[model samples]
Target: MKQIVVIGGGPAGVEAAVAAAKGHSQVTLISEGPIGGRTGWDSLLPSKVWLHAAELAGVAEHTAEGVAIGAVHVTPTEVLNRIKQVAQRWSEREAQRLQAAGVKVVHGVAAFHSPHELIVRNDDSQQTLTADAVIIATGSVPRFPPTMKPDGQRIIAPRFASHLNTLPPDMIVIGGGPTGSEFASLFSRLGVKVTWIVGAPGVLPMFDPAAGAALAAAMTAHGATIHQVDVERAERTEGGVVVTTADGATHTAAMAFLAIGRVPDLSRLNLAAAGLEVGANGQLAVDNYGRTVAGHIFVVGDAAGGPMLANRALAQAWIAGRTAAELSAPGYCPHTVVSAVYTVPEIAQVGIVSGGEGELQRVRASYTASLKAYLSDETEGWVELIYDAVNRQIRGGIAVGTHAADMLAPVALAIQTGATIADLAAVFAAYPTLSEVVFAAARAVK
Candidate 1:
């Protein structure tokens, strides 16, 4: 029986460990803290909980929209407690399941002693573990520019932002990525004066231009001041903090949260000692199968670069874990993965948007026509489908509206199975549901 060692304990690590432990392999999962990773504990789950509250608050504020809403209020302490409870429950449940499956769970910091050996340190003791294959699923950490160091009080990071017990008088969210926009939207909906700084010209630069514009407009209507410029520096001031732009203008706020993105957490591992090579951005270079430069050692999730979503990491981990096991088994193929971002109206996509011979013809439809959006009072988003003009097959799809994440599964399936636009349009979706928008969009592509 082969022994597999998985590091990190985040979404990718947990999924990889679970997948690798199946069948005859003896799997050992290691992490510095609890399982569930940063996404489950610090980012996605907590932010979504806050967003749920914000959505209810929006309904209350817009009572004229035909929905009778009572006085909505939130206690930050209660929200934090709920987040902690959910994270703890998930961690405990996953740990129990892995243990029952005969997987060894170790709480510690793991570093490679050699290509096949690891030294794990916990509390005051250290343990040496040897494995036939090692999967590096160690995730990334929130990044802060050298010019601005977070104090966790006035100037903060997302990890700290998730635990705040009180709303600030005024807040400035730096970085216009998905994280920044989500935080800005949540704070603004809670009636906090919010100034959202986007280094680029639009809110979600990675999304389609129209989608980004729609998001910016929605946030603006909800009382968020969007600033699209380079932020030079942030400093603690008399009452709060002052953020200076590259053009020399300064904005003051009671608190500032840095959403500047993240970098792979590989410094402590010392990959060179294990004959591994990192990419230009410091990520462990790996193919779709997660095989690193060392060949025997595999990397998955955020540490492997590309889209850093937790689900994406899990999908990649599934492929990596299976492929690693199949090195001794038979019949394995790598699978294409999908990625999603959870913001107001969510964002989801799958498959590559390629050009040339396999050029994709894009089909777009608005959620304004959906009865569910009308009844739910969430008509500010749309769905887009990309199809191969030659084969008429659905190549990719994106949605930004209520339950976009849930609706994206079908689109991802269609793309994975080479389903054409006509095929998707042929399927009947329940009327008055948000999912109907996808079929409608596919049908519009002619």
Candidate 2:
């Protein structure tokens, strides 16, 4: 049987190890931190827990007349504890699953001594492992600027922000991507003053400009001050932190959350020994099959470095693990990756693809058109569908408002299956539902 070694116990490494074990390979997973990486612990899971809390807070603000809903206060320590408990449970569950799948899980720091050999060191112990194949899924870390460092107190990154025991009186969020936007929204919901300094003119640069504009407007209405400027430097202050922007303006807040970006964590792994050099941006270059320059080695997850999405990591891991184990891998395809921003009245998009001019068509349906949204007093968002004008086939769709993420799945499936606007419109959507917006969008397509 082939022997496979997978590094990093995050989403990618765990999936790869499990998939390889199912094949004709003896799999061992090496992880320095707890398994499940950032997705299960520091980043995705924790953020969602906070987002859900924010959502619940938003719901409580709209108490019905004469309804005696007791005071709901934001408890930062309790939330942090809940985040830790959930992440621990997930990590433990993943470990159990890996063991059941016949994959050996090792807790240690790993570095390559040769192409096929790895030296793993844990406190007070060490081991040498050799394998016919290796998979690197070391994941990524928040990129801290040289001029400004996170003190883990006033100045912090996403992971640190999640673990904050006390809510700040006021906070400045740098970087207007998903992480920054989510933090801004969360703080706003917690009744904390938020100043969002977005690098881009609008937030969520990856999505349609309209979606960003809508979200920005909503955040502003909900009490967030936004600056379309990039943070250049930061300095420790007597009270908190002072941040300077590229536009030569200085902002001060009780705390600063740096959602700037992330870099692949390969500092421990001396890649030169494995004949791998990270790209200029500190990302590992890998093919669709996740193979690096050294054919015997593969890369996935944040180590492969595109969007830093957990689903992408899981998908790539399946391909890399099976191929490394000499099992047939299903051909990888560039599919529509659906993404969402879990703010109140969430924003979600599915299967977006670029097309030639005049060939691409867009149609929109407003939330106000849905009776359910009107009844629920959530009539402030819209759904948009993008389709090929010539072929009339749906390419992608975006939904914003209550249940936006939940409403996006069917559209994503339709896009994947090459369903047309007419096909979407033909679906039997119940009256007054949020999903009716999708059917409305499809029917509006001309």
Candidate 3:
């Protein structure tokens, strides 16, 4: 059996080890902390739990037929405890699954002893393991420059955002990306004053402009004060944190959050010992198959660098595992990955966009046209579908509204299968549903 070692134990690492085991290879997974890594513990799942609570509160506030519900005031410590419980449950479940699949799961700090060898050390033990091939899925950590540091109290990193014992009366979030925006939204829902500092032209700048604008408007409606200021550095004060902007302006708040971005965490890997080089920013250069310069060492997930998302990591991990184990597997293409931002009215997009170096046409439909949306009092949404006018094949689409992620899947499938606008329009969807928005957009494509 081909022996494989996977490092990091995040979604990517766990998935890679599982894939290798499925390919009939002997696999070992090494994780520095709990098996879930950041996604399972800090980022994805916890945020979803908070978002779910926010959504329930929203639904209660907008209850129709004059039904009145008490105000929802969530206790921060209890919420944080809930997040920890959920994360532990998921980590244990994943660990159990990996063990059942015949993959050895080790908790330790791992570094490359050689290209084919790993030295793992825990508090009380150390071991040396050899593998035919190694997969590095070590994920990433929040990037904080020396000029701006998190104090774990007033000024905080995204990882510690959920652990706050009490919500500050006001917050200054320094980043316009998904993390910052999600926190801003959460604070706004919980009746905290938020000053959102956006470095980009607008929120979710990488997505379709319309979606970003809609989200900004929604945030503003929820009492968030939006500012187009780029934070250069931050300093903690006696009472709070002071953030200095690029234009020499300063903003103060009871608490500050740096959701700027993330860099791969490879401090302990000792890449040089494995005949590999890391970039100045700590990112590893990898090929389309997540292979490093060293043929035997492969990198996946956030370490490989693209959109830093859990689903993308899982996909890359599967491909890397299969390739490393010398098993037949379908190659992964970066363009096919789906991006979703889970705000109140979520935004999801995939594939090539309109007016982008081809004969592409764009069509739009509003959630107001969906009977289900109207019934649910969530009619503030829209869909923009782009298709190749030459062959009528769907190229890409954006969904911004209630269940936008779910609504965008069939369009993503159409793009994947080279299905035409006509093919999607002809399909029969259940009436009074948000999915009908897709059919409307397809039919409107002239």
Candidate 4:
């Protein structure tokens, strides 16, 4: 049997280990904390839970149809407890499933003793294990600039912020990425004053410019103070934490959150000892198949340094795990993966956006045209489709609106299948639905 060692127990690690074990390989999954990864416990899932609550709170105030709510207030401690409970349940379930699949689960920090050897250390002791193949899915952690290092008291990172016992009266959120915006939105809805500082010209810069603007406008409507072109430098003061902009303007808040971005967590892995090249950011240099420079070693997830979504990590993990297992077995083809981001109004994309000159066919439709949006009073999003004009094949699609992540799945599948704009246009989506916007956009492509 081929012995495979999967490091890091996040989404990527769990998926990789599970998939590898299914291939009849002897797999060992190791994690420093309870399994299910950061997405399972900290970032993705917890954020969604909070967002769901926030959305409901919005609905309660706006009143969808005759549905009315009486005095809704969310306590920060209650939210934190729910997050912990869900995380614990998921971790336990994943542990049980792995054990049932005959995959060994190790609770420890794993370091490279050599290319094929791992030294696993926990609270008590250490053990050395050898594997024929090693997969690194160590994932990434939030990057806080040295000047703004979070003390975890008044100043914190997303991981710490998510589990706070009480909401601050005023919060300064640095970095206007998805996480930052989400934090700002959540807190603002919970009645906290939020100052959202975007180092870039606008928030959600990766999304379509229109989408970014709309999202920012929505957050602003909810009472968030948006500061563009602002770089925050954090400091502790007598009253509270003070964040100063590059222009020397200071803003004081009860708490500050650092959503600066993430860095690969591979520094301690000692990849050099394994003859693997790591990028300057500590990301492992991997091929399309997630193989490292060392033939037997592979890397996936955040450590691979592409899109850092949990779904993306899971997809890469599936590919790496199956490919590594196939090298030991025989036939397996990795599927094209889709990526999704769950911010308010969500953002999802698949395949590469065609930018270079070519016969390009594009279409866009507003969510306002959808009956569901009209009914739900959410008409501020849109769906965009892009196709090759020459071949008429779907190149990519992006959606920013309610259930956007779920709605984009079909487009992702179509792209993977080489479906054309006409092919998608012909498909019947349910009437008065958000998905119909996709169909409308596809049909508009010429």
Q: Give the distance in Å from residue 358's predicted Cα in candidate 4 to where it truly belongs.
A: 4.8
lDDT of 4 by residue, 138-246 (tens): 9887776768988888988877746678778999988877788777777788788999898856787766566678778877887788888666579887777999888
Colliding pairs, model 3: none
**Highest-TM-score candidate:** 3
Off-target runs (Cα >4 Å) in candidate 3 are 354-358
| Clash count of each predicted structure | 0, 0, 0, 1
TM-score result, candidate 3: 0.96
Against the true structure, what is each candidate's TM-score?
A: 0.93, 0.94, 0.96, 0.94
Measured on C-alpha atoms, candidate 2 has an lDDT of: 0.85
What 10-residue stretch in candidate 1 is worst by lDDT? Answer: 327-336
lDDT of each: 0.79, 0.85, 0.85, 0.79
| Tens-digit lDDT track of model 1 for 1-446 | 98899998777888888778775789999988888877778777788788877776666776655557677888899888888888889888878767877878898999989889999999899999998889989888877778887898999877874678999989999988878878887888788999998885568786666557777887788688988998989999889999999888899999998988888888888687798767788787777688887877888888877566777777778777877666333221222345555566566655654354547688888887678888877787788887877888877777777677777788878866778888998886888898888898977875
* Local accuracy of candidate 2 as per-residue lDDT tens digits, 147-181: 76888889888787467889888999887888888
The window of 10 residues in a row where model 4 has the poorest summed lDDT is 327-336
Pull out the clashing pairs in model 2.
none
lDDT over C-alpha atoms for residue 259 of model 1 = 85
Model 3 clash number: 0
